[model samples]
Target: MRTRIITAIVALAIFVPFVIKGGIPLTILISLLGVIAVGELLFMKKRLLVSFEALVSFVAVVVTILPNSFWRLLPAPAFLNPRTLIYLFIFLLLLTTVLSNNKLSFDDAGALSLGVLYIGFGFHFFLQARAENWMAFVFGLIIVWLTDSFAYIIGRKLGKHKLIPKISPNKTWEGSIGGTAVATIVAIIFAESTHFATHFSLFEIVLATLVLSIAGQFGDLIESALKRYFGVKDSGTLLPGHGGILDRFDSMLIVMPIIVLIGLTA
Candidate 1:
């Protein structure tokens, strides 16, 4: 518990400044995080499958998160476009499967592809969300943190019924409800106190927050499922009590994409 609190403080001290700056520095930070997350995922996979998966994930991160302007500046061929890169990677994976004498199964190929899309693509949207509006990004982070914290506290105090004992045994229905409620309240307070109130209608804000809060919980469950499948206790031990970059930012990965989509439509 003490290690967790100290790690949280040190992490915030480093992360908050980059989030506030919101430019190349933030991009670099997020890109590094994406790469580290991909590395962690590769480590979780079977040893024989790690090499190509790492390569694909690294390339995906580079293509997905780098600004379009950066791509434009490069004197690369048209085939180097992001979509083309993805297609080429898929083709290579299929070809490798055919040639490797059954060493790499379709399941391995699928896992690699899923890892690249899920982690790399998700972090791409995270960068886009922060670039769209730093305040909204901050608000989304607040919602996730508040929801998780309140849920844990409420669950410890009053939880009775299990939410999903298979995927996340510690979570309870009472905690889930308490977390969502706290997230909604925080959203309302944020909206009322900030300039966001002037831009978005009350209905829009409420709807968005409700979706984000639920999505955050689903994200947590998904990560828990991944850990169970991998037969690991935590994603990694890089952050002491925080597990890994993925563990620390799992909810953000899901929330940021939804937030970006909401911003686009609004």
Candidate 2:
């Protein structure tokens, strides 16, 4: 518990200032995170066969970091959106179906493409959120962090029923409910008190908080599921007691994008 608290504090110390500064620094920060995530995915897969896939991943990251001009020279936006993902998968299928001499299978290509979308596009939202509204983006982040922290503490003390024992044994229904409730309350208080979110109504803030809290837990569960699927404990051991960068920011993975969408519509 002490270790997790300390880690959280240290992470906030770095993340707050970094996210607050909305510029190339933030882009680099997220790009570096994307790189770390890619490394972890490769580590998990154990074989990044098909050199073109590696090139495409690099291009995706570059398109994410650099402006549209770099990617516009080629057609790369197809990989970022969901509707076009099927086409990209089909292209990969053809590539692996013919290019490989049984060195790569359809399953391998599908998983690799999925990883790229998951990590690559996920990190892009960090850039997107920062660019949209740093204040609301920061607010959304606090909502998730508070939700996860309070949920875990409350759940540990009062959790009764298992939420999803298969994906995350530590999770509980009570904890999930507690976390969302606390997060909603915090969002209301923050919205009422803070002048930064004056543009949003209190009701909207509450709704966003509820969505973010539930999605944040799913984000954590998603990471836990991935780890369980691979039979690995943590994504990486970069943090002391927090496991890895992914473990720390798993909830952020879900929250940031939602925040971006909200900011866009709001």
Candidate 3:
């Protein structure tokens, strides 16, 4: 518990400044984080880390996380967009299987490809959220933290039934419900106090916060499921008590994309 709190402080000290700055620095930090996240997934697959497939996966992740404005840096042949480049990198991963004499395997390629997309888009939208609006982006962060904290507190005191004992034994349906309900109310209050005040109706605010609160819980569960499948206690041991970059940011990876989408439609 002491280690966890200390690590949180240290990480926030480093992370919050860049988050507040919100430019090249933030982009670089996020990109590095995305790469590390991909590395975590690759490490799970073992041998693939040393293979050519890893390179392709890393490049694809970097490209996927680049903002639309950054594409201007790509010289000439304007039709070769980010999506095209990403697909090309994925194609390289697929081709690596044949080139490696099938040692790499199609299954390996599929896994790397999926990891690139999931981690890539996850971080990409995270950057997108920061770029779009601080208040809006922070909405995702606030809800996730609130939900997780409340769920833990509520679950410990009153939880009985398992939410998904197979994946995350500690979580409970009661806690999940309590967390989301509390998070939604707090998030709505937050939105009311922020930019969401002018643009959203009370109904709209309720609907959006409710969806985001629920989505945040699912995000944590999804990461828990990944770790369960990999037979690992945590995604990695980079953060000591926190486990890994993925462990700390798992909810954000899932919530950021949803928040960005929510912004788009709203």
Candidate 4:
């Protein structure tokens, strides 16, 4: 517990400044995070499968940063939504091919692809969010962090009934509610402070906050399920006292894309 608190403080000390600055520094931080996430996925899988999976994940990350027109390089009759088509193509391509007869077989490849899309493809959402409005992009991050922190602290203190015993035993309904409430409050504060007052009503802030917070919790649950199914604890030991890159940012990965989409539409 002490280690976790200390690590959180140390990470914030390093991260807060760049977040406030929000430019190339933040972009570099995002790129480094992408690299670390790729490393974590490779680390989680079998050694033999690591290379290929990492390569594919890397390509996904690259595609995320690249322009949408670049995807037109692929053979035609593409869907108006190139992103969806691209993901579907990747999924089908992997499902059809036989990688190896090993334990981490075709099924594992599918799982890894899911991770890639979750982490890699989702990052494009972050990029899009930032491109639209840097403030909105940062707000999404703040909302996810607030939600996770509230959930952890509240669950640890007052939790009785398990939310998902098979995945994350510590989570509870009380914690989930507390997290959502706190996130909603923070979102409202952010909207007002950032001059979203003219553009969005209190109801809109509340709605966006609700969506992001729920999505963020679902993201955490998803990662927990993945770990439970795989019989592993912590995605990797890359970060001392924090498990790994994925362990720390699982919810953020999922929420960022959704928030980005909302920002784009809004």
Q: Highest lDDT: which candidate? A: 3
User: Model 4 residue 187 lDDT?
Assistant: 75
Model 2 C-alpha lDDT per residue in residues 1-83, reported as the tens digit of each score: 79878887897798778877767777777777776775666566666634665555544544444423334466555566433
Worst 10 residues of 4 by lDDT: 95-104
Worst 10 residues of 1 by lDDT: 46-55
The residue pairs found clashing in candidate 4 are none
Q: Give the C-alpha miss distance for residue 15 in model 1, angstroms.
A: 1.4
Compared with the true structure, the alpha-carbon lDDT of candidate 1 equals: 0.81
RMSD of each: 2.0, 4.0, 1.5, 4.2
Q: Give the Å shift of residue 187 in candidate 4.
A: 1.8
lDDT, candidate 4, at 266? 54
When sorted by TM-score, best at the front, the candidate numbers are 3, 1, 2, 4
Give the candidate number with the greatest TM-score: 3
Number of clashing pairs per prediction, in order: 0, 0, 0, 0
lDDT against the true structure, per candidate, is 0.81, 0.72, 0.85, 0.72
What's the lDDT for residue 96 in model 3?
82
Candidate 2, residue 97: Cα displacement in angstroms equals 5.0
What is the number of residue pairs that collide in model 1? Answer: 0
Expressed as tens digits, the lDDT of each residue in 1-266 for candidate 4 is: 78878888898899778766755676667667776776666666654434655565666655554434345655756563447644864664374455443444566667666666677666656655665677777788888988988988898888887887878888999899888898889877887888643566777778878988999899889878877776789887866788987888788777877776565225
In candidate 3, position 205 carries an lDDT of 79
**Which candidate model has the greater TM-score, 1 or 2?**
1
Error (Å) of candidate 1 at residue 42 is 1.3
Per-residue alpha-carbon lDDT of candidate 3 for residues 120-178, written as tens digits (9 for 90 to 100) = 89898998888887788877788999999999999999999999999999999989999
Report the lDDT tens digits of candidate 1 across residue range 193-254: 87653667888788888889999999899899999999998888889988998898889889
